[model samples]
Target: MKNILLFIALTLSVHTPLKGFELQHIVEPSASMISLQTQNLCHSLYEQKGHLVCLPWSNPIVDTGKISLLAIAKTNEKGLGIYQRARDKDLNQSFLEEVFRNENFQDISGFAEARALYKNTVFSIIPLHFAAGFKLNNPSLPEVHFIEQRQTQIKLSTTWFLDNPLTEEWMSYFIAPSIYHFDRASSSGDYDVLDSATTPYKDLVQNRSLKGANADLALGWSSKILWLPSVTVHGYRLFKESSDCSTCLPTYISLDSLNAPKADASVSWTIDHSFGSSVFGAVIQGKRLFKSIDQDQSAFAYIYKISRLQSYASLSQNQRSFGFLFDANLYQLGIQYSNEIQATALQPKRINQSYAYTALVL
Candidate 1:
């Protein structure tokens, strides 16, 4: 997770014309694992055996989760060091799986050398909530309403399409108006102790991203179907680090019609040489999504997160264990964790890796 602050540039809400007091918002949630395993952790996360998620698989420490899938990594690289030529225009399934999951699979000569080149490692997402009245001029709707209540009915206008052609350049903006959260798990199964409500803190986050989109068909949610063949962007911002303080601008493309519905799920993924982009990143991002039971809003879910490390350069570069990450909450609480792996080289070079964090959003 990098500098995710200041992306809120309020350009005066241009009301489209509304009649009802209905609201609309969007949300996206994402989670993944990045590592340098040499086919070690790979087989463990992918392989399914005897009704148990075992070898060839990386199972969640906790068996139960609301999320649909869990990604795991191996070489953090694309194209085989064991196969194919240097051309990365077309990577295979193995490559896509490894980088997407991004679980630590490889061990270097020492920590000192590993930390020197590593740049980023993190698992996160960005959520947006728009409390606006849609259908501009609706007879039953209010001119303006709290979008907070519209999250539950949020839905996509169409099944997202791919093959639309991807993009390259990322936008230029500071912290964007968004929601974010994450958890760092110890060897233990517990994810966090925070309440999902308290986890994101508020509408802003630090060194986070608003969205990240990828076009590698192999990693697609409807991998065989939807193809949003365009360059996706992941941006974020921190509105408040203090309990109650002044906010700042957020990062984004500033597209007037780019906003979407509040999504209960935020899909994310990546592709190696197969999906060419000297730098590849994307997010199935949305603005917000809340839940309710018996007409009573039970919970509102949103998150904002960003992370860029210098590891796996061209598929293999400076690797660092120091990064940011989070997970889905359970029972009554949420979870969070951060990592910082550094290197100090003397005649006796040493790699100082420190992993410390707290659990709970209360």
Candidate 2:
């Protein structure tokens, strides 16, 4: 009778309307139990489930302009380990930089993140992130260039889960909305040439205030034969004041107004098998920028379009609490490949640059 009642309560919670103050505490424990079961299947699965539950609260859409700190090290061809490089150039050339030269890549970077979860009438979570780094290099110029970077972000979200009769799986759905502020400042010193001529350096400074609205749907099957899939759609808009650039040249050309909205979509799939402990799995995910317009008069408008596709794959082993992932570019039909450098002064070519990341659950 308790199980039946629990099931009935779960069904009602899934269909409940979203209200500013509508808190439902009755279904919290059952959702937590399901989360625990998913965790037992594998650490990656656990992390994925946790992310799905917190997606709405964490604000995945806002561009905090944060880059991965661990990416400073370059992965070898074998994808085994990382080696020390002269400077972390890739860190400075992120997609975010397309909007502004806000970050300075450093040989050593630091980042810290914290999260909190609560259960009441609804599931709520908060996540905080901070990062700092620096970069110094001589790009065949007479003077040395120095860059320092810092970023911080915080988000609040609420989510709900239910059983799907058609797929015979648990469906986790969420609506996440968030706001964030980010800033990047760069400075360089003048250099003296052999003939005692001085070359001037210009400092670039920029900051943006942005808001995002996102929704996600995730399906977790009870049977091993089924695959887990999740889809997310997000939209972002910049504040009017944040669009003004005082020093550095605009990173991207805008059409009509800089406040135009940007749309993004992501899809992910995972499959679990018997291996380490009770859980092991592989995941493939892809993300694309669906909507954004550039002014034809802008120098980059001809070469750089807002359309982009990035895909990733990973293998998980829960017993060791360690996993690795690979990131690459995917070619799309009807999409023209342009020189990224000519379009955005970023990359020389649209090469399928590949990188690997290691996941360690602490």
Candidate 3:
């Protein structure tokens, strides 16, 4: 009887505890790549009104305006995984706000996300998960500008395990589908300064009161065919008809609706190898955006139409990880490139972006 009990205990200990508790933190900062003239234009617009009327010309300027910090904690015990993440963004100090502030910007914008997953549930047929997240932004501009965003998502995923006949090694295929609801609201401010000619500005602000549904599909395959490589593909689409724009600004000629169906697809390939206590890996990815049905040439669709390619390599020593990444167009590698703009020279001459990140995992 004692021997039997000892055998059962050893089996349980070997099968459980796949992933231990982990805590991580990340910081990302972006700077505007636009020219000085574009910065001046954004500043002038903000000065004319209480807030910037629209998304920036290059959009990269807007992207550069914010700094983000994130903290995450996760644990997987007995096949039940739980994770929580919190992110904070310095919206006022961002390149966007710096152009207007002329000094350091200082408003806090951030979000919190939590997710729960039950693996091998339902007779080991699928994994069930749910996630919830929210973000808020409070700008320091006059008249009080505030924005709040919320999302809820549910997913069902499954994996198929196989054995390679030639290598006699294990392989896996994974697939997941998710549905989510996203909503955002922007508090109405004193728009008295914006006149008829600046009607687009009003529309931009009021359009923040949007609600819609979206769906995501993801699939992945892993094998040791070529040095233990894996490939993953993900796609998402938004339902335009379900989007509500009732709170948008009123216009006599009925401006083109900015709420349009949008979709994006991306694929990534990665390979990893380990030597002693150190590991090395490389990843390549490509993303493409589909043109929206709303042919309003004045909208942001033009910017979203550009595709991007990304490549990165990483080295990790136990709990420490570091990586360098580059993103750009595959065809244009030089400095005189110009494919991101619609009409003006607002886009940067070179579309390349370089970034690096380091993480300490505990």
What count of clashes does model 3 give? 3
Q: What is the C-alpha lDDT of each candidate?
A: 0.20, 0.26, 0.25
| Backbone Cα, N, C clashes tallied per candidate | 120, 6, 3
Better of 1 and 3 by TM-score: 3
Candidate 3, overall lDDT?
A: 0.25
TM-score of 1: 0.19
Report how far residue 354 has shifted in candidate 1, in Å.
13
Query: How well is each residue in 66-85 modelled by candidate 2, as lDDT tens digits?
Result: 22211111112211111222
Top lDDT: which candidate number?
Answer: 2
Q: Residue 246: error of model 2 in Å?
A: 4.8
Over all chains combined, what TM-score does candidate 3 have?
A: 0.35
Q: Compute the lDDT of residue 102 as modeled in candidate 2.
A: 22
Runs in model 3 deviating more than 4 A are 1-98, 101-110, 120-171, 186-212, 238-241, 246-362
Runs of candidate 1 exceeding 4 Å displacement: 1-31, 34-230, 243-362
lDDT of 2: 0.26
